[model samples]
Each structure stands twice: as C-alpha cells, then as structure tokens.
Target: MTLMLCSVAAAASAHAGELPRLRTEDGRHALLVDGKPYLMLGAQVHNSSNYPSVLPQVWPVMQALSANTIEIPVAWEQFEPTEGRFDYSWVDTLLAQARKNDMRVVLLWFGSWKNGDSTYTPEWVKSDTKRFPRLQKRDGRPTTTLSPLGEATLAADRKAFVALMRHLREVDREHTVIMVQVENEIGSHGVARDYSPAAERLFAQQVPEDIRRASGKQSGTWAEVFGKEADQAFAAWTYARFVQEVAVAGKAEKNLPLYTNAAVFDATGTAMAAQVASGGPNWNVLPIWKTAAPALDLIGPDLYLPLEKTYLGLLDRYARPDNALFVPETSNAIWAVRFFWAALGRGAIGWAPFGMDATSYSNYPLGARKLDPATIEAFAAPYRLFRPIARDWAAIASKHPTWGTAKNSAGEDSTSMGSWKISVTYGRNNFDIPWPGMEPPPWAKEPVGGGVVAQLGPNEFLVAGQYSRFQFMPVDPAVNGQIMSAEEGTFIDGRWQASRRWNGDQISYGFNFNEQPALLRVKLSTY
Candidate 1:
C-alpha cells in the first residue's frame, strides 16, 4: 500500500482564483486550500504581535516550529484607529512577509469583543459609550464587555470586518490568508447576560421564531422557553446574531471560510453559565450558536484544559458532523502537545497553540513559562515529522478510520482498529518484559508520550508517534495475530522512501517509538 502526498508547493501553484474552503463528508472535514486538502500545522503569535514592528520577532519561531500557517490577530483598534479612514499597512506587511516565508495566515479579527472584553475597539468607539453600549451587570453598572444588544456596535463591527475582507480580496489574490476568525473569545464575564434596560425589554419579548424552532419551544419569552438556561441561551443568541451579521457582510466581500474562537469552559456541564464565558460558543451552547449564526463556517475551542480527559472530551464535543473541529488556540505547554494527536484523530482541520512567538511575553498558567528549547521541541517534533506528508495525512484522515492517544496520568491508552485491538503504552523501553529488579524508566515520570494510527487498508496501517510503544492483538480469542512486515520510512515529495525494514529484534517486541520521529507502515495477518 502507498500513501500519496499532497505537496504544499503544488497547492501554492494552483489557480490564483481558487479560494480556501472547508469540505465535510461522512462526519469528517478537510480544509481545502487551492482546491486540494490542506493541513494547517499552525502557530498563533502573541496577541499584540500583529504590527509591522513586532513581526521581526515572529518569523524565527515559525521557522523553528516548522509551522505552515500563522494565526495572528488584526486588532479593530489598529486596523481602523480612525473609524471610517481605514489603514491596511500592517495587513500588507503581514501578507508580504508571510508569502516570503511561504506561510498561510489565519487572521483573527479582534473586533467587538476579545476574551469577552471590548479592549480591542478603536478609541473613537471606546470614547463614545452611548453609541457602543457596554454590557451592564445585575447592579446596573456597566461592565468592560460590549453589549451584544447594541445595533450601532454590530453595524460598526460588521463595517470594519467587511473592510478588512475587501482589503484582503484586493491584496491576497493567491489565497494566502486561508481563514479569518470573526472575533476572539467572545462572551460576557461577570454576568450571564446584559442587565441593561434595553436588554431587559428584549429578554421579556418572545424568543425569535428561528431560536424557538431550534430549541423545540413553539413560542414563549426567553426566560420561559429556556427555563434555567434562559440567561445564557439568550446571551448566546444575541452574540451569535451579532457575529452572524459581521460574518455575512465579510463573506459578501470575500468568502474565505470565516470562523470564531470560543473560550472553552467546563466540559462536564458542572460549571454555571455565569462562571464561564456565558455568551460565547462554549460546548453547551453550540446548538444555539449554530442556529443563530449560520454564516459562520465553524466555531473552534480555545483549549486551556491540560487534562487528558477534558482535552479529549472537548475534541469529541467540537468535532461534530455539523461543525468541523479546528482548535484555534490551545496551550503551548509541553504536556499539551500530545493532544495534537487527539485532534488529528478527531479529523480536525487545523490546530494551533497560543502565544507562539519570539516576543518576551508568555501566558504562564495557560502555556509554557518561557520559550525554552525543550518546550519548542515538544511542539516542533510532530510538525517536523508530518510536514512532508501533511496533505497525505489530511486526505487519509478525512476518508479513513483513525485513532490517536496521549499519555494520560495512568501512562497508557488503547483503541480498536478493524479486528485488532491496538494498545499503546507510554514510557516503555525496547524490552516488553522487565528484568528482575528493573526500575521504572525515567520517561515514566515525565509528561511526554502519545501517537496516532491510521488504517490504510483492512490489514495495513500507517503509524507515527513518539515516546510510546504500540502492540496489536486480535480481538477474537480464537485467532492469533502477527506483524507480516514493518517498513521504517519517511514520505518525500508525496512519495514514501523506505530507509530500512524491521525484523527479529525490532519485531520481537511491539514497536517501541522513542523521542525521535518514526513513521511505520505495518502489514498484519491473522494466524
């Protein structure tokens, strides 16, 4: 069996008129760039690194990480500091530099809200509080977040977003900007919904017909329709409608697969709406967002949760048939890198870690404290290994059944492929059985191990991973299984070149993959 590579170079040379789009089939999705499947091995720079001056500190990290795409923010304040008088200088600079480095861009529009705050709005808008109203708390005191109920705010944000898209159309004809994030971590913080007089009037009004139908409530006020989740549900609808208008207008200018990022909260449904980013597209409210914002291609989660259960659970929640999984922001910490496999197994179109730049700032508890070599390598290793066959993997994942896992606190995980049970053990050495009095391995205590396996055929598999050991066993108790052949190879320019074959000592024990990048094509047979 052979795996065909989708060459990035070939994709770049496609017809310039072709725009990037998301294609979904059989509950799987692919980000098609230049009319072909594209895998975004992406890095998101620091929030303030969008200007021309700070870009000098960004490129080196992209090169080091081997990232093909950069998710950088284009602040509303900076993009249109003077409102109607727009400036596209920084965008032009970014596009020119990105092309020079052969990188695609995922522009984050930090408009109406960012992390549920209005800090990114222009001075003109911020100074005029009456025109762009802020969300009011229960005490009737205005909060920092912009009110989703404000028509003026939505109109202004939609205008700015449209202008940015129009500018992109004029400049990026080659489709260098693969996608645009409508806003960043949108929602309210202190309260579930705005308590202003205008918001109160609307809250008492009957829920819109579309929302009523989506929620299976024929007709009633927001409070009556949603019951306990009334406030959050209302808030979600308000934000979704606001963003939908902006996305619709922007798409009209140049449709390039628009999406928004959510500040993920409790996945277990224990956290109250008021405790999390209430109005955002959190997992619980995805249905509301989907029904309200049909124009948005997808809503991705900004994963800060590092636990195996939570991280993997969130992936399952977001990777649905109606919504394509695209992790726009995740922790850049060493332990978090393994979830890259989890995302891939879920058929995620793209995954990016937050705060990936040479800038001296770091979002500590959320990511690595510093950009150390170890931290950098943790993320770089997977990208380096998959860079050559990214397109191939994307295509295969979109079509085939795949499974991936990371070393959990228990240090192991397993899944089934066809008739075989594939078990992966982390921190294992070449030896399957420990000698007398053998101590545990050093990596056993370390937080680094995971891998992904894809079924190429009924009895053939493609596997790549690090710091783990893979063993396959027959599911049927009566049958025995053995590896027919295992080839160690790497894909180059869409072709697999075998460097060697594994047998005897190598096949004596299950495949032991260490820190070094290893790709294996193993054919199995039942005896």
Candidate 2:
C-alpha cells in the first residue's frame, strides 16, 4: 500500500499543471488521471438510490465488487427543487463518501432527460407546460419527454448544469469526480419525434448545412434528404443541439470530459425506433449527434441487447478513432464479463454495470437488480485483476494491438495479433505430475474460459485471462517461434513480483490459467 501511494505521488509530481484529460495514441484512447492512464472499473447505483442514507448500501456493495468508480444520478429535482435556488449537499456528501472509499465518480446528470422521460426535472419546470412544454406526438398527444425545441427548457437545463459544474470546480479541485455524464439515455420516446410547431418548422427547412455535411447529404429538406428516416434524424439534430448548448455552458464553468449514453435501437429497427428513444446517438443517428454536439466528448451505448453479436457489433460501431468506447451501463450477469475483455480489446477506457446497490426496481431487467453475493463475486474477479495493473493496462492498450476470444465447445480458440498466431485452450492443470491426460476439467464443457492477448512487441506478449491456456506461433514461416521465458506474477507497488517460473511441463504444452485471472509476461525468440 505504501509503495502504491508512492507510485501515485510520482505520477502526480510528473505532470504538475495538467488537468485530468483524455489522450489518444496509436489509434486508441485513454483517460489520464493525475498524470497516469487509469482504467475505470465502475458500478452504478439505481436511479433513486443516491441519497445519503441509501449511499451506505452503495459503498459496501461497490467495495465488495472491487469497483474503482461509482456512477450515480444527480437529479435536477434534487439539485434545485425550486426555481432560482440550488442545493449541493447531495454532491458534497457523494464526494466525501467516494473519497473515504477510495473511489472516483461519474456523476450522471438527470436534468432534462433520464431514460427518455423528463420525470427527474424540477417541479417548477414540469408544471409550466406553456413555457417548458412536453414533446407533442403527431396526433396532438403530449408525451412525457421534454421538448428539445423549447428555449425555456434548454436555458433552464443549461443553467442548472453550469451551476453544478461551477460548484464542482470550487469544491473538487483535486478531481475526485473524474467525468460527468450529461444525461441518461437521452432521446424521444413513445413517438418517432416531436410533432410540435417548432419541430415541424425545423423539419420543413433545408437540412442544416452542418448536418448535411455530417450525414453526407446536401441542400434538401428533411423529407427530401433522409426520406423515411428524416423524422428520427430531425429529432436527433434538435436534441443533440439542445444537449450541446448545455454541455458548452457546463464546460465553460469547468472543463471536464462530458458524455451521453444512447438507448440503442434493438433488432426490431423501425418499430423500436418509432416506440423507443430513437434520437440522441443511436447508431443510425450517430453522425447527426456528433455533428450537432461538438461539446460532447463521446457517446456510448447502454448494453441491453439480448444477443452477443448485436452487442459486439455495437462495440465495433462506437469504438471508432473519433470516439472512445465506454459501457457506462450494463447488466450484472456472469456472462457479461466476456464483453469486458471485448471492450478492452477495442481500447475502451471504462466498463460499468448499472444498478449495483442493495436495492431493486420493479420494471428493471433481471440482471440489473440489486446485487446478491454471487453477483458481487462475479464482478469482483475482473475488477480485482484490473485494479492492480490499471496504469500499465491503459498505457499498453493505447499503443498496442490486442485481441480477445471466448471459449468454444472444443475448449480452444485462436486469433492473430501482430506477427503471432495465438491459440488459446481452456482447461485445468497442464502439468503431467498433476494430471497426465489431455482431457480438460468438467467445467471446460461450459463456456467458462475467455481472455485478452495484447502484443507488447513482435514476439513479446502480455497475456491475462481466466480458465485458459495460451500457445503462440510465429506467422512468418521462415522463422520458428519458441517461448524464451514465461513468468507468472502479480503487479505489486508498480513492480512485477514473480510468483513461480513457469517451465518444465507447464511450458511444454501451454501456459494454463485457473478461474482466477493470471497475468503473465512471455518473451519469444526465433530460430
């Protein structure tokens, strides 16, 4: 612990005036904290579970889960209950609790929108429908979503967000709060888009030049330019512009990385887009949001998709050089751990499961409820392993190419990274003294193995995985590859403490890892 503290101190000392910022290198992105790249092992609380009394439940569970950051809501209703007055007791309390627990925070601002509903808005704003109107449907029915076209609505949200940022700057100069989520799953719901007069007027005009440039269209009305998808595109433009204004205001107060999360379009596409939140950064509308909201740092998707390919595809879509991949909210299911490796392989800065406290919501998904003991154990595995090598992992992730694979029924999988073709097999003891057979453990029958391989050099690799074995072969036929050294170790106090030199039978077949995550440094040579 003392050495860890010294390492942290050294990092802070190295960069005297640099504020917390995001850096991109070698086509990958990382969040630099206190002059060192940090990976966020995060868990979020329920929407209504961030008050002082409820927070006690939050810390214990997060600590048990080994989360380094807590994502919780700071609602507009709670922050400013009345019109012109603000209360920051909630924010102060959260900072104090996070400091005590040695955790960082990604404060989710539930201002104008939370899950496509304005239920978290202040009472004053909600009551004045004329001044701050709700989004009107095509048939003259008003939805619960706030109209992004309203000047009063945007102004009020911008004011409140700026106030919160100003307060954070005054009280949190050390940056206990690392990032701020501008809103929660923001978009229009229950309708494709607003049918109000203002929205209709904007839709009727020539598609804004910037939006046209972003979406690769030119000089046409929404209907003419986008055809059937124009409604959702128009809505995305207005909503992103509104959020962008709020973001610009808050950044003016204190510049910190700000992002928004999308309620991704499911497989049903048209129906889902019509009924669910279709605007804000959904894959199809991502270009519109990016062009309209220049103030936003990144846009990430909430992982609610049921299929693995769909989930992985979304990771590929958003994991672009221009944007950083962050799963700010996800399920707590045991199988979800594989996506953590997937995200890391794509150079994501963070991964977090939503609703992690000792509380439950009626309408929530099964894996998104309060944590049970088993769930905590499931989450703790990856977090405990990553927390130690967080700095190293972030540094390596930005500049090096990496690959990850989930176990197959055959208990083996292979992928290419750099000049090596890496083969991974899942099983138990590899040593002949313990078990002389090639057969795997009973658990190997299940999808219980997965790992990430990062190429540190042409023949040198950093391998971390659970319940798996690794064997690397050179891609160049003329060169024969053989492992020169394989040292299994733990990163303690910023130094690798080798536990056992893996040789003899261990290296004869392959390097084996148990259920616990094992970090190894392997060097290869050509003959």
Candidate 3:
C-alpha cells in the first residue's frame, strides 16, 4: 500500500509540473499547452453563465465561433456559499462538458472584485462588513469596493482561492484547465484609494522599498514618491500586493498559469486614474503591478476601446518585453472584430470577446447590442480562418517576425515586413483602381478590413485577412519585386495544404481578400 501511494504521488507531481505556462523568447510570448505553443481562439461567456443549467447555452456558441477555449466565470459566492464550506459541483460540470466539447478552459475567478465591485462575494462576506471591511471614501463613508488594506478580507479571499487551486490539482489531472484568471477587473472606481484610517496611516508612511525602486523614486511616502499621482499609485500598490498574496497561495497548491485582467483606463491620456478604475493594471501603473505581483504570469487588458489609435496604442503598451498581451475581454461588436488582427500582429498570446455566450444578456454600449447571427458571423469569420492554423500561427509567431493591421481611421493601413512594404486598402474591387463605370464594393464604406502577415523565410510570407487588398512592394525602388507564387491554403496538423493558386487578375492588382475565409502562402522574388 505504501509503495502504491508513493507512485501515485510521484505521478501527480509530474502532472502538476507540466501544467500550462507562459513562455517568452525574443520579446514574443506564447501560452505553452501540453508542452507546445497554443493559441487561444477564445470566447468568454457572460458573468452568470457558469451554472450547469446555463452551460448548454454556451457550448453551441463556442461551436459557432470555432473557439478552442472557453473563458467562463466561477463565482466565489457559488463556489463557497457557506463560510469554510466549498462546493466545486459547477466546476466539475464545467470541466466535464468542456472535455466533451473538446475545448480547453480559462476559469475566471470572480472573487473579492468583479468589474470594480465586491458584488460577487458571498453573503457571509458581504453581510459582515466589519470583518471584511469595505473601502472608504474621502468622507469616511464605506463604498461597495472592498479595501485591499483589510487583512481579514485578504486572508478570506486567499483561503478560498487556495482551496479552488487545490481542488483543480486533484480533479484536473488531464489539464483541461489551461489557465486561471485571478480576479475580474479589479480596481477602485469613483475614488482613487481607500481613505480609511488604516489606509491613511500606510499612505503617510514611507513607500515600500520595492515599489520605490520599481518606480525609480527615492525613499519617501506615497505622496512624495508619486507626487500628483500619489493616491492612485498607493491604491495600485495595495491592490497588487493583495492579489500577489492570493496568487502565491494558489500557485502553491496547483502551480497553474495565473493572470489578472485590468478594466483598462482611457488610452487617450485624458482620463485620470480616479475617473477610471484607479488601482487596476492600467498602462501607467503597470510597473507597480509587475513589481508587486511577480507570481502573476501576465496582466492583461480588458479592451473595449474600438478606435484605431487608442486600441492599437494599448496593444503597444501591454505587449512588452516584460509582459505578454492577452485581451481577456473586448467589445463583441462587429466593428471590434478587426482589432483581432491588430492583436495577432503584435504577437498576442490570447484574445477573447466578452459576453460570447447565448445567455440572452447584452452589455450593449460596452459590447454588441445583440448576439444576432450577423454579430456572430462578424467574429466567426476570423475565427474560422485561424482555427485550423492556430497552433501553427502560435508557434511561428513566437519564433518569427510577424505584422498585423486593421482598417485605420482613413480606411487604409500599411506595414513593412523584411525588405517588402505591405499596404492594405479596404472596400475595393479586384483592381487597385476601379474600372470606368464600375461601382464600388458594397463594404467599401463599412468599418471592416484587417489582416496578419508573417515572414516565413527571407522572401516567403504567410498572409490572411478579409475585406482588404494586400499589395507588397520592395522597399528599395531599385529592385523590382513580384509575387513568384501565391497558394491559397490552410494548415492541417502543422502541414500546409494548398487548395488553389492565385494568378493573373488575383495577382495583377493585389491580393484582394473578400468576405471569405482565405489564407495565402506567398513567395516573392526580385526581377
């Protein structure tokens, strides 16, 4: 009996060590699954769609989008309704159904904070405000946001998170759960930092040495260290430390790749921290979050800004040498789908549109007003094109040079890959200039156009996009560049299967990508 137990224990340890993780090389990152690079064609369900009864509404949507990963919530209230008592029935059901559907899971832990509020906490935690204190406003009145400074609250949340991780280790030996989100949009909205007596005491004291060094400031109080941004900086430090404790404890249990999503602040440099979610992992406070939460694999942005510059700018901020870009949530509007190319171009590890389930709840102004067929197709088109080649793309992107673009505010975009300059124009016909008396395409004025181009070799490229014309030219005008061959195909089990070849009219003007799922492997040559 002793020998058998030892063997079982060794196997479990091996499995735990092989859990999903993030790998970064040459400033690009990949989510390593089953010891190989994996791309997340992900769809995040609505907040309340984790119940067994509601799960039936989710799988069909996952099938519709051709998503390989399901990002769903596991509410702390539902997981531990009674204090110190745990219930993982819903988690088990979710894992079982995901396996049946052949989908991986990214469990969003809606604990302590959900969208800048503590509403997801159990009745026990919510009712007893004294034990688990709430954040105080400037006037000393308590707000709905919990105080990260509260030791009791931290201890409770840490204990619950650890329990969840422990249970995952026991039941998830097959590694169905690829990643875990620590919390949802954690931060303080309306007010910058907790103004409670305890919070104020810490605020007046010298800033922690680690944070001071990370921020490149001399030893001083929060106000002295951060100056005008003191309040927001303090809040970020407090929240980051709180999340760090929880993540550390949880990792000790299962060692899965854990991350936290930020309710992104304004990218225009106009809105202040208090105006947005102050303590969240905003672009400005990313250094603080990184310094405080070293255990977290990454801090992902919950992108909702759909504009050209602002959206792309946030991608630049998060997809850094130190951080991997993962859009854990974005608007599911048709117009927002093009940003997927932008993210892919930046070598994002994962991207998911929020509220993707058929739960009949619409976030409206934040996302699509409805989950109609057209809305579904808008997202489904891009997923269909990449689903078969996701793993291939993930591996190539991690090791190769790639570029992605979306229709700009001016209805065109361009980038340079190696010696070739690639430009794209949306809403055009097969010809670069329309023939006399020809009408413009129906989608000419529509808000759509984007594609991703990856350099496979010195003069070879893999290209894919929709509703745009991709033209490649040699950077040096002295050399004449031409498309030697363009093969339309998809990657099957890591091999490219060419369905047809494009020539004559197709290559005459440029590679015109209509509203179809098409991928191209193009080889270029100089005349």
For 94-157, candidate 3 gives per-residue lDDT tens digits of: 9999999999999999999998899999999999999999999999999998899889999999
Model 3 regions more than 4 Å off:
1-17
For each candidate in turn, give its C-alpha RMSD to the true structure in angstroms. Answer: 1.8, 3.2, 5.4
What is the lDDT, from 0 to 100, of the residue 85 in candidate 2?
A: 96
Candidate 2, residues 400-464, lDDT tens digits: the string is 88787666556667888777888887665566355455665666665456788778777788788
TM per prediction: 0.96, 0.93, 0.95
lDDT of each: 0.87, 0.82, 0.88
Note the residue pairs that clash in candidate 1. none
Top candidate (lDDT): 3
Best by TM-score: 1
Question: What lDDT is obtained when candidate 1 is compared to the true structure?
Answer: 0.87
Worst 10 residues of 1 by lDDT: 1-10
- In what order do the candidates fall by lDDT, top score first? 3, 1, 2
